[model samples]
Target chain A: MSVFVTVGTTKFDNLINTVTKYSAIKAFQDLGYNRLVLQTGAGKIQKELDQLEELDKFTVEHYDFKPSITEDIESASLVISHAGAGSILETLGAKKPLLVVINEDLMGNHQLELAYQLYRDQHLYYCECSTFVETLKSSDFTKLKPFPDKKPKLFVDYLDNLLGFK
Target chain B: MDSELGVIAVLIAVVVCLVPIFSIYFSVNRTCKTKNPNVTSTKRTKPASVMIIAGSGGHTKEILSLVSSLGSHYSPRFYVIANTDKMSQQKIEALEAEKIKISNKMEYSIHTIPRSREVRQSWLTTVLSTAYATLYSFPLVFRLKPEVILCNGPGTCIPLCMAGLVLKIFGRDLKIVYAESICRVETLSLSGKILYYVADSLLVQWPSLHQKYPGSTYIGRLV
Candidate 1:
């Protein structure tokens, strides 16, 4: 199975570093993963990723930002991303299995709320930046619930009625 | 004496015939050259024309879902997006395709304005770009003359909302609805901060934000 790692539009240096660290890549290798795609947006971790690219065992590819990030997300067996709302919603919207890692350095502290809520709902796995490798190694993916497709009909009706449409 | 009275009767008949003609001309001219263009009633009659602001990714996704939820009441929509946002255009087209499969009657237009800011870009450039975007949006808003404008929290929506505010100042009645993104459960984003004051109605996806911003209405998670 392929693994897709993305940090979304903003910079998340710590999350990128922790995920692309030597030990974390080794953990994926131990799980017999053949392909790994890393999308590090504005994060300064290319040198570390380049060094890992030298190894011949598995393919490692990285990009800053691309319009085709959705295509990559679709092809991957699992998506490991920073807890940005855009990334989280897109992953879940596409019905992809996801594991969101929170970057504690965000100023507003909303990412933690989103991650915890999704985790509590059993929609996807959530973890902190430091515990990347540990969670990957111990988590059981087969038991996770499929992402529920939520239709916003109620909220839509509320707004429409408020606008005096009905 | 009888000849003079006949002439007098003929003159009075001519005056009576010209009176109604002159009054019709004056009334038609008044309506045709009225100063205010928005003479139509603001109340919803047929489907209200809607203008929705769509940013990249989550903002666009949420706005699209809201557009779908509008059902058949809001039609001939104008989806204003950033100039570089091809993803949003693609998503809209995909939705349009889906709509056509179900029913072939969705009428919408897409307009692209300059981006207000890029991620991690300098604030100096952001100010200039935002000014340009706001200027560009003015004509689009005036031409569309949408009865309502809808947006979630995104920097691109700021200029469009500013345009709506200006229209409101000009006595054009337009409803501006700003719904905070569901991702923002705790606090408002920068765009949310600006629109919270200006929007006709402000909605928050989380209750905590509703408590924090007392002016905002909460309707649970929208996405």
Candidate 2:
């Protein structure tokens, strides 16, 4: 099983730090899946993405921060994010379930509005930064499926039909 | 004819009396708040020093369009990369003046680095211009050192602005905001979506763009 976590701004390193010590970074090493968090920040996160010489299960690949979400979403089994709305839709497009970690409460509560809206809309699942790893690492990603494209969600079609003639 | 002349004379008299008075009123109204640049806005936590970057023509115009409102909201510094269109150049210059004359607000900056025809057909030109644009904007962003940067899209904004996003990640306290344009009403531009992925906040003037980038927040129309 491969888990690709891309929370733009690579500070997911901070989130992972919050979850487990340098010790727990060991357990994932033994799991035998290509586990890694693509630090998505343009450059602002922590300094040393030191090798988890201890946890060999995940190969933490530090991808240069490219802001294109479409490119980021390509071929990922699970999408983990900072509850930014862009990630939500891209994950939906790829038909993958998302694990969102919100910085609203972690940083300044700016995300609470959007995160709450999505939560209420029942379109996504969110965890605060503090509990993100616990919630994310435990997700049954093997069974992950896109939230049903239920009820003829014709967003693009509706726009096309309205604007096509004009 | 005399009556008509008399009416015209009266209108002229009114205009003669009102012109300077209106100007004075406008001056006073604009200055009353601007003398203190930090007259905070409800948009963000504090009154941010903002840099709004855009390409030459429509993109530049659209970016300038927001300056007045943004200035009213923050200590806005307009940074424009002169797009090639003459109309864009003239209008942006004109708007820059208007921005200054009204509020006595003079925090405007303009830079024109040979607009690329900048997009390319061949991969080489694309890569070269992309590289050039990226290299070009690096110094501009560092020099301005704004707390927040807004991009009004087309070709010009992404280069300098995207680099700024990368800088912010490295611990620059810059907040990146992208205002996707109306031209994108039909197709959400790839640049806009990329901004959606990276921006601290993404804004769209139209509701459809908002729907397209459901991840974005819709701020009101720009101009």
Candidate 3:
């Protein structure tokens, strides 16, 4: 199975480095995932990624970005992502097991709040760069609760009622 | 006697100007005081016009997703975006195209306004730009006179909502609905904070925000 790692449209060099570590690769292999698909965005870690790929311990595919990562997200058995709301929602919407890595270097800690809240709700697993490897090795993906389906009707009905349409 | 007449003239001029200013202020304030979301108006069988404020990136995504769920009854949609925003127009078109494939009757327009504040901009420049944007949005809001104005956590929404308030002061029924972004679990964003008092309906995705601000309604994840 393949594990997709996306950093959205921002650079997360620390996340990239942590996931490419030898121990992390071994953890993935132990979990029966032999391929790694990484969307690196603006992170400058190509040299390390290349060396990791050459080792051939696992298949490593890396790209800066794509117009849409929906296809990759759909096919992945697991997803490791930066704590961007768009990425988090898309992964949960796809019903994949998501482990969000909070980028502490970013100016605001709002992403941390989102990640922690979702984690509290048992929807996903989240950790900092320091604990990413250990969390990966120990977290059970099967325990995540499925996010509720998008209910656009709620707002529509609310608006309609407010506007006296009903 | 001439000096007294000069003073009287100045006083009259001040009163005349302040009368309209205070009138406008009190009208807008009255709209804010009436926070009842369920207050129904005249029943209308026709579709209502809507003006949507689309911010860059995540804000644009969330607002459009909310718009896509809307049925055709909310028609002639007008989208306002920052002129520097390159992605929102494309996303809006894609969404409209998908809608057209399903129903074929789509009426929408896109307008661009100046960014209220670019990243790292000085507070002084932000104030100037915000004023300029509010002036720029006034005519657009006046002409469209959309029944509903919908926005999420975008800086651009402030000016548009201000323009909507202008419309309300002119004796038009305009509703401004502000939805806090889902990412905001504990606190509201800057735009959300400002629009809380001005918007007709304030929606929060998480329960914490609703608990913190009793005025905002907890809608439970509309996006």
Q: Cα lDDT of model 1 overall? A: 0.75
Off by over 4 Å in 2: A1-166, B1-47, B83-86, B114-120
Task: List where candidate 3 sits over 4 angstroms from the true fold.
Answer: B1-42
Q: Against the true two-chain complex, what DockQ does each candidate achieve?
A: 0.27, 0.01, 0.49
Clashing pairs in 1: none
- Candidate 1 deviant stretches above 4 angstroms: A1-79, A90-98, A103-113, A116-125, A137-149, B1-45, B120-128, B169-173
lDDT of 2 by residue, B1-223 (tens): 3323332332343344335534554465332222322222322334456676766544665565555344333455656564455656566577767767767866666666444224323443444454555556655665666766777665456655655664564456666777665344434554565456677767665575687668877644443
lDDT of 1 by residue, B1-223 (tens): 3323332332343234335533554455333232443334444456678898998877898888877666666777888889999989999988777766656786887899988667655555555666667667766776787778999856778767766765665566678999887877777877777777889888887777899999998866677
lDDT of 2: 0.53
Q: What is the model-wide C-alpha lDDT for candidate 3?
A: 0.83
After TM-score superposition, the amount by which residue B129's alpha carbon in candidate 1 deviates from its true location, in angstroms, is: 3.8
What's the TM for model 2? 0.43
RMSD of 2: 20.7
Model 2 TM-score (B-chain only):
0.68
DockQ for model 3 equals 0.49
Residue pairs in candidate 3 whose N, alpha carbon or C atoms collide under 3 angstroms = none
Q: Order the candidates by TM-score, highest first — what do you get?
A: 3, 1, 2
Best by DockQ: 3
